[model samples]
Target: MNNRAARVALALICGAVFGFGLSLSGMMNPIRVRGFLDIFGAWDPSLAFVMAGAVGVATVGVRIMRHLSRPVLDTEFHLPAARRIDGRLIGGTALFGIGWGMAGFCPGPALASLPLGLPAVAAFVVTMALGMTVHDRLVVRSK
Candidate 1:
């Protein structure tokens, strides 16, 4: 396959694997996710295990990537260059965590649940898109 085709195929495969993992881990369920965040209430610790597993895999993946000179389908790693932690980073993270805790749906799981045809999911996706667009125009473009 050509480089572009290989990249597209890899992205699709990765997305499918991610969606399947989310479904199997019950991350697609808002109740379970909210339970995970509710430490003072009826908290569920199972999501912590899932997060740990993901982090462990990511740690190993990063180590493997560090050993590779370049990606299989790319000329370079194309990793993020930003290293400084500023107010914008902290604010963005706080907003993201608040949103996730409130809605029990991060972007990944929210997108994964899009096929369920739920009005809540539709609203979440639309709001998320508007937020992204606003950030792009106000923050990213200004940068």
Candidate 2:
């Protein structure tokens, strides 16, 4: 297959695996997510395990990938080059935390939940796209 097709195939497979993991781990359930976020209330520690496992696996994967000269599907692993935490990063992180705490749905879980045909999921996805578009426009204008 061609490079673009290979990239698409890899993305599809990875996305399917990620969505399945989220569903299986109960991360796609907003109630569970909200419960995890509720530290002072009836907090659930289940998602913490999921997150820990994800982080551990990602850490190992990155380490292993670093040993490779090139990626399996690309010329190089296009990792982020930035090292400093700027105001934009802080502001974006705060906004993401606020949104996640309020809606109990981050981008990954929100997109995965779309197949359930829930109105809230659909609304969240729509708003997320609008926010992304707005951010892109603002960045372009600033540049």
Candidate 3:
């Protein structure tokens, strides 16, 4: 009914839809993601389509949102305009890639796979959460 409630409802619906889409598309399966990433092995390129679709949707969404005078429930759209190349950004990206390559699971897929009750997925999620907390407290604070 209120602005906060509307935002929370929208977030929940969006998250549910995203989780459903990930599960339906087989993106939540570590084996499938590993197969896609293994270029020299039995590489499956289907994940490329998934990523392309996401990018396409995001592109359109950003374009439409940019043209709006203001956000529906806010004064303006708070968009990031940072274009600075920094060590923190590069290091974080490399770490993320290395972790994803090793575990065959990104944050989204790791969380989505929780319903399957896989031990490795659970471990990954736990470690990811701990890492996030440490980063926020230590690395982010030092910056």
Q: Candidate 3 at 132: error in angstroms? A: 0.9
For model 2, state the Cα shift of residue 133 in Å: 0.5
Best by TM-score: 1
Clashes of 1: 0
lDDT of 1 by residue, 95-123 (tens): 99999999889999999999999999889
RMSD of each: 0.8, 1.1, 1.3
Better of 2 and 3 by lDDT: 2
- Model 1 TM-score (2 dp): 0.97
Q: Write the per-residue lDDT of candidate 2 for residues 80-118, one digit (tens) a residue.
A: 998999998999899999999999999999999999999
Clashing pairs in 1: none
Q: Write down the TM-score of every candidate.
A: 0.97, 0.95, 0.92
Candidate 2: Cα lDDT at 108 = 97
Q: Model 3, range 1-143, lDDT digits (tens) per residue?
A: 99999999998998999999999888888788888889999999999999999999999999999889998878888977988879978998999988888898999989988988989999999999999999899987998
lDDT of each: 0.95, 0.95, 0.91
C-alpha displacement of 3 in model 3, angstroms?
1.4
